[model samples]
Target chain A: MSVLVVIECANGEVKKSSLEAATYGSKVAQQMGTTATAIAIGDISEENLKHLGAQGIKKVLFDNDARLKNFVNLAYVKVIAAAAQKEDSKVIILSNTNIGAAIGSRLAVRLEASLATNVVALPEISGSTFKVKRGVYSGKAFAEVNLTSDRKIIAVKKNTIEVGHEAGEASVENFSASLTDADFAAAPKEVIQQTGDILLPEADIVVSGGRGLKGPENWHLVEDLAKALGAATACSKPVADVDWRPHHEHVGQTGITVSPNLYIAIGISGAIQHLAGVNSSKVIVVINKDPEAPFFKAADYGIVGDAFEVVPKLIEAAKQLH
Target chain B: MKILVCISNVPDTTTKITFTPDNKQFNTAGVQFVINPYDEYALTRAIELKEAQGGTVTVLNVGEADTEANIRKALAIGADDAIRVNAKPTDAFFVATQIANIAKQENYDLILMGKESVDYNGFQVHGMVAEMLGIPSITPGVKLDVNGNTATVQREIEGGHEIIDAQLPIVVSAQQPMCEPRIPNMRGIMTARTKPLKVVEPTGSATKTEIDAFSLPPQKTGVKMISPENAGELITLLRNEAKVI
Candidate 1:
């Protein structure tokens, strides 16, 4: 039995979350006294596939099907399931991304494996039992889950596990599932990706804004500070609801959850819903004109000053650091 | 077009989360339950579609009797009828199985739900149900429009979005900006009291996973305040002390 890691790639490069998954899968493989093999999907180069070795993967399986470039839920599931069966994998790991969650859930049903998503830690295996800790209730709490099935599927939340770089190179092998036309039935007609901005979920640092930033016209304050820190930009739910930002940039209980290394909240009041999405950041910095803002309680550092004044100074300081 | 919109009754977003003494289950004693905020998007969109086109919208839930209030709230909002699978929603697979069985028997043209429930936050049921029913599923859908036998969906990705097309009999999980969730009117609420709410026994007998315990996240000790004039010091602390910069 082996561990199978599903590596998601876009535009010929591996996503940071998938790299974390590879590392987590390798650790799980080590704990089970087995090896980890990665099944890479999308239009990634073989050279990039071999880089999984840094995450402790021993072998890389690449399917160079042109049709597999974009995500097709059923097609990806068939390919991953084929890889798992071929390797006789007892444990399957994937990053808890939109694509990953889609494939992992379907694979669990098809393979009769117990599935867990938003898993925050590695599994604890003792004898026949496998247990994992996962965030639940929108990160307000966590649950320790026991997987009772013979086979298991885990979707690790991004930024929770630390990525490790070990010395080695993984051997790349070609694999095919012989996908049919039906597999491409639901393929996307057009995909529009943001060209230059850092993706919020994968960013190491995030700078977010709220209604206190005044209007969409004044959003450059948030962006300027983000640029200084080399961070991604985000906003609370209200900011997105009023068209100040796109829905994808909204981080809250009802939106994307991020766990970056640092989260800077400017003018955001730290609503519980908003906090649910960002409270997992390693360090939180809150800046608001209101001294009694709820976000201050959850923040590592707080500055009770106008964003109009504080953010520009912070940007200046960040620029002068190096 | 017959649409099945799944809803979950969860604690209000502002509720303070707590666990029982044993920590095996959530402490719901004082928590006020409402229709999950995300699912409301799905419910509202489904209602709007039903209004635009000519079809019936049915609301489904996997919960006990306590969930019926939210189920009724859904009915009041716009659904024609409701179904509550008499079960605890043990796990994603179990819940998906229940949903799939009903969809298979009824042959719903569209299955709609939130991307994930707020309570367990398991974003698995939609795909699991779609797989079980041999249908295509789109998740975190920001926009959905139906024309004839084809359905168009705008699905959210990491940085942007994708426009996808699928034939009839598709599953979609809704996200924000889809539509503003509607509140039930007095007339609708009065009519909802008479709407059919069928409670059926769960067909799935097995669950793949079990929750061992629940725990709260560690709280921040306290915030280190910085004077407004020394705002730049915060960045210095982030670099030197926190080492995060």
Candidate 2:
């Protein structure tokens, strides 16, 4: 009857990927001739929840529980289920994030809904059938999946759908799930937030380095270029493996997958696994001393040169643009 | 401790993905299958725990006969035994149901698996199975250590990571940096041949989702080669032509 969207907020601001989920949910609601309702967990301002209307949500449900601010899987699932029951929601939409994956799968079992994750496109509904396209094979291929259950859950991949801005404002309502102590059992004992100007998954432009940078000492070239471009810094798996960078910054098949607007690879050979992680970027620039590097084939632009000489010039040129 | 580690057989990471003519199923012809890289972490960690704590590690897979080879490989890597539910993993829900049913019968103290299968990339099984069995699930755990009945798991979040502690009977999905996946030695491989491999009929037939088709991603046109001397020109083109800078 209705579409429910899970809007994730941190420090009182909605995450960029959740905004896209809101937009995708609203569009699905429109196609179903119903309105989209959003259920937000944790500590978020009412003003910020109301802003969900800009993404086509008509109603925003907020459970202002302090414990929910950090992700407690059971508690979050119970609250979202309560909202879905209240709204008679037939479809649930969420971003395919770490929290979303934990919540969506459990929610699917709890609600007996058909579940799909890593979905990249809208559902094609024909009569009783609802099919969605999702990225499979580590971004190498796509799979069109049909949700057979009456209730459906979709986890949208980041940077795949465009967020919409509409004129209307959503009405914020207080929602209470009456969670208990048992729900918080698996809550995190400690949360460590990465100290960086830009997060790789949310950044529009990403500057990544690889083993070609030679050593961690020369990482300043990659960082300088990233700083000049105002982009997030990433590296290949080998760099992360050798303790040159944190695993969070590694973008490859087994690492974090990024789909930024622009991805600049410095000194990184384009390995198949690495390409699998970043091939979704809109524009790819490869800078490597080996002109025959396989990465050049997948890149949109290539400048064959040594990173020691080329990165500084690129940084200077990027700075001049400002 | 009775640890159950689930593994999936998938195409080699470098395998060229292709679909059948109708595009409804993956073309497995001539493609070599390996134990999913992520699941290797879980298997190795379980083996390490078994060795240190003196417990049994069982490797489980929800697949047909074709997947038995990879299941044997997991046993070769040091699982005490292996279980194969004879069914094609149609969807995450169905697979979870099968796993939950077996876990309910066996009563595993710890359940381990990959964060997601590289083939389908469905990060759902661990949570779903945990929910089905009425237990806690921690996912993409980069680090895990167990002391008595309690498990301390470090899981990845958006910007960073979180460390959480849960009681026994918890499901944990492994990510990288958890442990170095082990390769089977000749002695282990010989023992794996005699290891008890149990194949049971799938307990459930209901699947929540169905695959309709498969397609490859759009190919990139040729790369625009820029002179290393005119590196700045690349920036101009990115700003003007690509409009993505």
Candidate 3:
């Protein structure tokens, strides 16, 4: 059986997480003495599909059905299920994304294969046992899960793997999975757009404000810093609930959980609820006037000063970088 | 409009993390466990939907007998019935299998759970269960609506959010913005006592991914001090010594 990786694309480009999934799937394929096959979907261009070759993907199955353009769960799954059957994939890999985990789980049940999500490392294919280490307890710890079923699916966590671009002139091929009307239903009637410079999950850097900012009108200081640093903007749960910021920007236990590379919190006291959502960042910078703020406890670096003064200065300093 | 809500018992978010001598087990002494924070969103939303639409809600857990208290609490919060798949939640795969086995026998329209349990944070089970049943799963959705057999779910994407549609017999792993979590009140607490909690043995094989050794993260270093005024000095310290910029 071969390894199959599902690569998601948007506006003709592959997502960063999909690259990591391909690298992961290819390595798993190597362990099984086979090669990896990728199925490209969504609004991706053909040129981007070739990049999979650098990650050791030998073939790409492209199902460019217009019905599949959007993330219709049924349509996408039907097409992917078809590819997995055609490739005889004993292993399927995807990102630990809303789309990825959602599709991965449904696909697992459909195929009668065992599955694991939020996996942080490669599997230990010892004898008959195919096991993988998965993050549990919200990044607190891990557990090794064995897929007893012959077929298996895994969802890899983002930013956990280093994407490698092995030097290569890769080839791209197109294949089809004939989807019917039954495969596509309940298409989104409306798509709402929220304006922001960066999407929190996709951002390389994030600048967040909290109750410490004092009021909604003072948001400019935080926005200016985010703009100067080219970072996404976020707020603590309290700020979101109080309408200081939109609920979409809330990051905490009861809000969006993000794992960006760099997280900067300005004028926010770190509650455990907030920390659980963001403790996974590669680096954390907390700025609070209260020296004993709980946020400073978890921050890799911190600035204990007034946000009105600090944010402007920070923005000016960051502006000089480029 | 029936809903199935999945929850897990996890250590409180503020509990000091400690490990066993072998580092394989989390030291449970003096640690308080609560329903995973993520699952709270699912539970609250399920109850809310059932209250409005008029249907039963079932709470499922994959842990052993000790997890019954959480199951009961879910019932107190408005779930009609509870099921404890008597097993240790060794890993996501094991937990998913158990949920799938139990779900197959039920006629629920929607399956809901937290985006990721505060413990293990696998975030795989809901999707895996949906996959097992050949059903659609929408994860980390902040908003959900049910009309007849179709469900419209608003799931967060990287920067924006995506609105997706799926027929019933779907799974939704909930995050915040779905609804605010509600505290259980006196009347609901009184009614929770008689809720039927059925315990079932898991059907799938239980061998989890092999763990070589578990290790807690390195100890946190001393909290460094720099005067509030010399903020620029800290940057220098980071650039010169820490080299983290």
Candidate 4:
């Protein structure tokens, strides 16, 4: 049986999260004594698929139909189902991002496979049963899940596992599926991407602001720190709705959920909604003018001081480290 | 309008996660299960929709006999009926299969579910179920409106949100904005006891994936400080010593 990895691409390049999924799926295949086959979606090119070899992907199956370029639920699921069937895959893997969560789950239903999202580690396969550990309670804890079905699907949480790189030449092949126009009927009408260096979900290190910076104009301190760290910038929901930061960067219960390896919150009061989004981070550092900020309760480390005084120092520290 | 709300029985958000001695299964010894937080949104929203439209709300769960309490709680919250699939939710596929099997028989106009479970967090069941049934699926849907057989949904995208319109028999996975979960009033809890909870045996294969072991993340080191006035020293420490800048 084959281990199939679903890889999503944008701007003709594979997303970083998908690369990590590829690495993860390949590792799982290695442990299972199987080969890792990747199924690419969206506008990714063949050259980019070849580059995925560095992550130990042996082959990539690219669906190049123009109708498949956009994020359409029916079309994407059909494409993935077709690929999994063609490869006779026993396990399917992808990143636990918006697209992956949306598509991977539907694929599981069609394939009648066991699925686990937000999976943090490799599977524990003993005898015929497979088990995986996943983050739960917004990262407050972990749960070991057993997938007794023969077909399994896993959506790896972003930034949870390091991407493995090796030197190799992967075989990239063009895949043609017998999909009808009905599958493409629900294609997205538009593809809009937020323009910035700081993408919250894709960021390795995220620098978030709360009520601490005092005003929107004072956001430069937060921006500078994020720039120096090459990390994404975000804000709490209140900060976003109040116009201190754009709504796109809001991370909370009603906003975007992220699990970056390192999350730094400045001046945020750490409301439950806000913590719910980022609590899954591997390391949480809180910098608040008030030592008793509620968010500090969940922080792995804390600093009781002004973010204005602390952020620039952090930027300088990051630059020096680089 | 006939609405089917899917909820998963999982440990409370505050539960400490652990594995069994062999690490091949979840350590359920001290775990107190609760309705998945996300699914609560779905169940409540479905109830609210039914209240507004004078339709019926049905709560569906796939689990063993122990999870029937949660199904009853959902009924107490406002559902007209509850369906319990007699099986363990070993994986997303197996769970989705059970739901799809029930859906095939119900022919409901709208299917509602959580974005993901609090425990396994598969996040795939709703989409998978929708696909299996060949219906429109909008995941992480925050807001929903129903008019006759037409439904409009607001689904969260990466940076913003999208407004979508689809006909009846669609699948929508509810997140926070769907609705605030209603606490069961004393009267509702009492009425829930008599509501019909039909249990159905699952028609699916056994699970495939299993757990290997559980290991807690390394405990973090204590905080180190460079005096408040010497803020720059903290930078030096991060750069030279901590090396995590």
lDDT for A266 in candidate 2 is: 96
Tens-place lDDT per residue, model 1, B1-245, is: 99999998889999889998999889989889999998999999999999999899999999999999999999999899999999988899899999999999999999999999998999999999999999999997999999999999999887778999999899999999899999999999999999999999999478999999999999999999999999999999999999999
Candidate 2 C-alpha error for residue A15, in Å: 0.4
lDDT of 1 at A10: 79
Worst 10 residues of 2 chain A by lDDT: A193-202
The candidates, ranked best first by TM-score, are 1, 2, 3, 4
Cα deviation of B43 in candidate 2 (Å)?
Answer: 0.6
For model 3, the interface Cα RMSD in angstroms equals 3.1
Q: Give candidate 2's whole-model lDDT.
A: 0.93
Residue lDDT tens for model 4, A183-202: 75444444456565666788
The top-ranked prediction according to TM-score is 1
Q: Rank the candidates by DockQ, best first.
A: 1, 2, 3, 4
**Which structure is stronger by lDDT: 2 or 4?**
2
Q: Please provide, for model 2 over B1-245, each residue's C-alpha lDDT reduced to its tens digit, 9 standing for 90 to 100.
A: 99999999999999888988999889999999999999999999999999999899999999999998899889998999999999999889889999999999999999999999999999999999999998999998999999999999999988888999998989999998999889999999999999999999998599999988899999899999998899989889999999998
Looking at model 1 chain B, report the run of 10 residues with the lowest lDDT sum.
Answer: B156-165
What TM-score does chain A of each model score against the native chain A? Answer: 0.99, 0.98, 0.94, 0.92
| TM-score of every candidate relative to the true structure | 0.99, 0.98, 0.89, 0.83
Q: Write the per-residue lDDT of candidate 2 for residues A1-322, one digit (tens) a residue.
A: 6899998887679999999999999999999999999999886899988888999999998998877888889999999999999999999999999999999999999999999999988999989999999999998999999999999999998887888988989999999898888788789999988775688888899999999998999999988989999999999999999999988899988898899999999999988999999998999999999989999989999999988888888998999999
Q: Give stretches of model 3 more than 4 Å off.
A: A27-34, A54-56, A122-131, A144-151, A193-196, B204-213, B220-245
What range of 10 consecutive residues in model 3 chain A has the weakest lDDT sum? A185-194
What candidate 2 gets wrong by more than 4 Å, as runs, is: none
